[model samples]
Target: MKNTSQSETISIIGAGLVGSLLAVLLAKRGYQVEVYERRPDMRKNTISAGRSINLALANRGIYPLQQAGLMEKVTPILTAMKGRMVHDLEGKQNFQSYGQKVEEVIYSVSRGQLNKICMDAAEETGLVNIHFNQKCESVNFIDKTMTLTDELSNESRQVTFEHIIGTDGSTSAVRDAIHQVNSSQHDIIPLGHSYKELRIPPGKNGEFLIDKNALHIWPRGGYMLIALPNEDASFTVTLFMPNQGEISFENFDTPEKVKDFFKRYFSNVVPLIPDLSQDFFNNPTGKLATIKCSPWHYQDKALILGDAAHAVVPFHGQGMNCGFEDALNLVETIDKYPNDWQTIFSEVEKNRKINGDAIADMAIENYITMRDSVRDEKFLLRNALAFELENRFPDYFCPRYSMVMFHRLPYAEAKSRGSIQEEILMQLTDSARALDDINYSIAEKLIKQKLSRVQLNPN
Candidate 1:
């Protein structure tokens, strides 16, 4: 690692979660950082409703907070979710533990609150300056200049920088500029699904209306409704369904239709959210997409990170965590190759692109698993067997979900091993209906033959 230096000034675009955290990390390295965000300062202004998704902070994300020395402040706002609480139409509930150990849990965090905390941390660094409502109109890589337009006044200003990093988001001006110069391929693949954010307010006397420790999911094969707990004893609930299907957001146009739809599907949840119809009609429906692009940097003059570079769907709840990982990796790479911006940017993209793509694919796959497969007894059986295998073969086998959530294993590595584990599970559970009926001898043999011993140091 290189020693901190104050000579370099880094201009970062966007003051969202990743950008704010990146500002803190860069400032800690003694770099003079300036951040420009298109949105108004959320702390001073009320955030726009319905667009915010509850973030699932896992080990990958928490490590960066720890590295930035902000975990102490972040912990209080986090609500630990140990498992998925699947609610059936009949109101029967099934809890699926995420992992074996107590520490193997993900956190439910409000995006707005977390972003505010990160911004506060960045400002506390004193070396970072964040300018809000300043939208980047364009970037001139040739001259190392960026044009920022004041959102309020529609006035534009030219800014010069030593180095520029864009955490702007999916629709990024920096990314558009980079693509103009470098002939790179990019695609925004829509999931054909949209989501509406609703709220489950607290009970009387500020009491939690439901279980506060688990992420609640009402899965209907073609669509799903998920709720994450908040510190205020309320829950941030999201409903994801197709945009124009027989049973979709398009189908429920009126308040009566919305109430009837909820009563038909998420019947148990209708009572918890008193103004369900109002929330459904009032909250805007947000689109879901996976944004992919290559050559994320432009000759070291500029680079983009987080959602600007790779935006995945939120099914796996790794969007924020993955972006945080990108920030962490970029800063670490800079430390490793100080003064070599080309190498730093190249290494950052090389290290993250494949992993980002892997997680993207996995996120889509998880959407199906969450919405459809969770109802399968076979899926539950495999999940249980995965835990047993990890316990039995400790070093050789770890479930893919566990590896992704709890361990520092590369996302690509986890996906690969998960495929092998899935095959093993299928073979082992071929004839068996439950864990008791499964033959241990075949499982041990298959695991030993298929998986190599791994050193897992989970966070």
Candidate 2:
């Protein structure tokens, strides 16, 4: 057996955000790190399909970047978003705070740029090696080897390493190899919804036409549209709609039809998107899915992280955040159980799977909330009451959204707590609505009792 003190070679598949970050962290700790990526260097690329350059980086992702010492390097490139600006069909807007104040801003960053930063940081480490355009063809856990084929040359090569990490993403090749060897059970459930990206370029003289400090949302009962700021003073808009069977763009292909649909449904956003009809015709449709699996690691020889292990919908904006957290958690585990590869891998699998499942479920539920429930009169009333309650009892009656997005609570715990909070708020709202019909004193007592049971002290 090799001595525990000796340096070990670690191979990481996929040079995406998580893989590159993990490579840098491992290399800094004196391990030999090799990263294999199937795509060409993004820095030199002119065009790439199916890649959305912009994403929202909330507190969940920011904390990990700060710990990795890359937050400062990337912060200057981000645009701060303080809240959501909701647009009504009549060209009116309403502001909803995401946090306590204006200074608490989530960042809007370019995903490609962030990936480049991580890749460059990993390369700067003398112990790290990167092979772009090298695709992993197969992996033999019994032999501790991976077969790679050069995409350009069509030549195959073999590499051996002590440990392997997979961050290859939702359609991960490394994940498939691991499943093949371990006979793991996995499922990918596709939501019936599909999305398409549109753009609202800066107005004349390179000025933004809308507020850059807020994420813009236009919810229309059965579907929703959202826009986030870009560094170029533009906005990247996305429209989430039902797939083939439900509402679609087939009948609204012509410019006249598109304009009429926008006029009736999204009058405010229609004017902002100048090339609306062209964008609708040119943009490719994207599918949404949730990936679920158990036992993320296999016998210390191979492991998976990020979207490869669990891919959630983006409604909660936690996909990248959770992936970044996965890297931090794995590194922390490695630090605690140094040189004990098997135990460390086993523990990671157990802990991450539990949290991943929790977040996936939350993300799915958030989709429903965003698409249909956002405009519900009853739900809005409940939200207003909850916020009012928070003002009255700041410590005890925080809203569920505030806790889940603003606090560092565990994903599973947040979901459970949020469910409880919702029940109490619903009862309170119902009682308030029927105040004139029922006995006022009795209703007040019942509301207080429910609040007390949930630890909410509404003074």
Candidate 3:
């Protein structure tokens, strides 16, 4: 099935979501592909319990799945999360819609299920071969070779390739090799916050304890706890806080302190989890970070995609979506320049690098919005006003969140326009509590003057 006239084949590292998806995408293009995964076959083994077992899939990710002809396979495993259901300290709940329309909602998906489906699809093509428990040891772009150590046999094998793509996640061995060659190429910046996972099982009748259609959050100033529903009527709960602070993970060392901490802030959640203290102490605490690297491709010999190139925090729910977009972008770019590897790599890297950085920065900003601003009165007012402005100036105005989640607008463009939108909102909300008190004439005039317009979206 190899389309190229040359003898060289494409090799991929990491069989996680991005790796499997990339392998399928490349195989579909008639390139013989082989993948190496560090972990055991996830389909046959139970996934390790850790933070963020599920992922939020938005339009950016869906576009790629649709491209791979996987939406039908993936749709059944997904549960729609229309918006953020914010819970107050007293257990009061409020729903905030994520998008303007019904069809604009994001989805909650299990990581293990999605990875298995992708790998299955790749292998079903018969153009891809995946070797499990083969840990990537090193990648030599100069020699066009990659050495993978067999976990079972403790043997190393060097595989040669005409081209290589590293879709390995954060702590990527492929990326580490690139760093060794070029020390100043990348930096992994920690966000100083960590997260721990807690589970909320379903009721006796298999009913969801909370509204299953929404992503739930308990936003405290500087810290928060979030939950997303799973198919089994259960929820995967996560507690995010500073690594070292007045009321951080450090302070929740003892069982008594963990109990009291949940009682103080997540009082309503304490009763939902029978083994709160046990889960809190037993589960691992995971760190959040952004991996910013340059020159995604090492000449034409090797390239890095997904988390290997840019790893953003999960605050905006775009981490997986962005990585999926990377896979789609590279495949399409390669399609355009099939015979020219350098051009394909350069074009993809040039186009995706800014968007990658843009999403990373936006994810950090959204963490602040999620933890503190979601519950603020002014923040709510501005959020409502942003939608109002979008209603009036539909072409010119779209909330940054909507742009990032619901629309295909480039992330860099969204971030740039969002800064301008923020200034306008600040001026319009100056000393005003609600939209009724504002001057519509002045608002319309200022919007027209400062913001350009196009044909409105009928939807």
Candidate 4:
């Protein structure tokens, strides 16, 4: 742990996952920390109203949990998903391993549950203070004051702080405040895709009907249905689709239309959803967005992290993972510059923006890969070859999915490495297909060269 100057007082807004985890990390380092959340303590509450997709905690997210020493407490609460179980139109299932080994598993945990664990951990630190139902309305950086309103009482209060950190969500009030103060550079671009959550209840015997070790998917060309395992032996399913103008609820309103749509498109999982029509009609559709901003910090007194800084789509299953990583990175930066808050803020802004933009692009590209490319014959063939390559060269040629989801490689670096691996696989496949003149020795030499290059320069 790194010690910071005693003069610095850090106030974090929003007790969501990133904010709460960051509060713990900062407090552990002997900093005076306060966290403000707009809603009540989630442990006492039921389902959060509009949370669409639950979290799929991969290596990046798990590493932070371990660092915070909360992984031991939360690991038992998650269900492991080792691979993807793809469903075909005829109800046949195809298994695709996420990594070479089954131990490289992604955990399926509820967003609310994970947040509660982080909040409880932060509270236990005793060096941190948590304020619930306190919604930050504005920030006065000049005066170093934050004005917050009580959601229930409709009363307002002001508090003074040396520095403020905004982990407030995508539609963050602190972000809005930053925009008001610094207008020219910030922008939040909303992706046109909207998503909705549905459920697949457990069987009568209280057992999983589908394989619990795998994440289930029903890819429908333009749209897709995905399900993650739950501790209760049920599954939380989500559907991603275009909003009102493209495939609006109006056209999908009636039970007959909904039934026809599901039966034609996602027949394998349609029957599992008991209230298919009602769920489709009643559930609120969530809009996806990617937020881009220059200079995430507002001078030495304040900075933003988490969704407030970068909000990517869920296709890559990395929104929360990236946010958790943000907290870890921010703490490290602060540790590196214990005396100079200005330098820490500047460095975080510079590095985080690059990583954020890289992930946003990868997330969008993954949407296409998830919803469309899964059905392509060539893509499937290439995936098979990649798996075989991984088996043959266990330490060297890992699939890009394994690197991104099962390893701690940065998204930008993963994209670059994955692109090179793809090209090598294409060349190898082309050579192998030309069996009239077999070139096994040349292909093996080429693969070894590529592996050596990756080992030398893994960035």
Pick the TM-score winner.
1
Off by over 4 Å in 3: 1-8, 49-51, 453-459
Which lDDT values do the candidates have, in the order given?
0.90, 0.79, 0.87, 0.81
Question: Where does model 2 exceed 4 Å of error?
Answer: 1-6, 249-259, 391-397, 433-459
Sorting all predicted structures by TM-score, with the top scorer first, yields: 1, 3, 4, 2
Residue 400, model 4, lDDT: 80
Clash count (model 4, backbone only): 0
Candidate 4 lDDT tens digits, 347-442:
888877787878888888888887778776667667777787777665667778777788876777777777877987777666354333334466
Error of 2 at 439 (Å): 14
lDDT of 3 at 416: 85
Models sorted by lDDT, best on top:
1, 3, 4, 2
Q: Best candidate per lDDT, number?
A: 1
What CA RMSD would you report for each candidate? 1.3, 4.3, 2.3, 2.7
Taking the tens digit of each residue's C-alpha lDDT, what string does model 3 give over 379-444?
888888899988888878888888888877778888888888888888898888988877777778
Model 4 RMSD in Å is 2.7
Better of 1 and 4 by TM-score: 1
User: For residues 1-459, what per-residue lDDT tens digits would candidate 2 score against the true structure?
Assistant: 112332788899999888988877676666788899998888788545235668888777777787678887889889988878888778688887776655456788888888889888888877788899999988888888899999999999988878999998999887888888776889999987878888999989898889998888888867888899999999999988877643564445577876787778888787789899888888887889999986688887888999999999888888888888888777778877887889888888887787788889999888777767766777767777666666655545667666556655567666776776687676666756532333435434544555443332111
Output the worst ten-in-a-row residue range by lDDT, candidate 4: 450-459
Clashing pairs in 1: none
- What residue pairs clash in candidate 3, if any at all? none
- Please list all clashing residue pairs in model 4, or write none if there are none: none
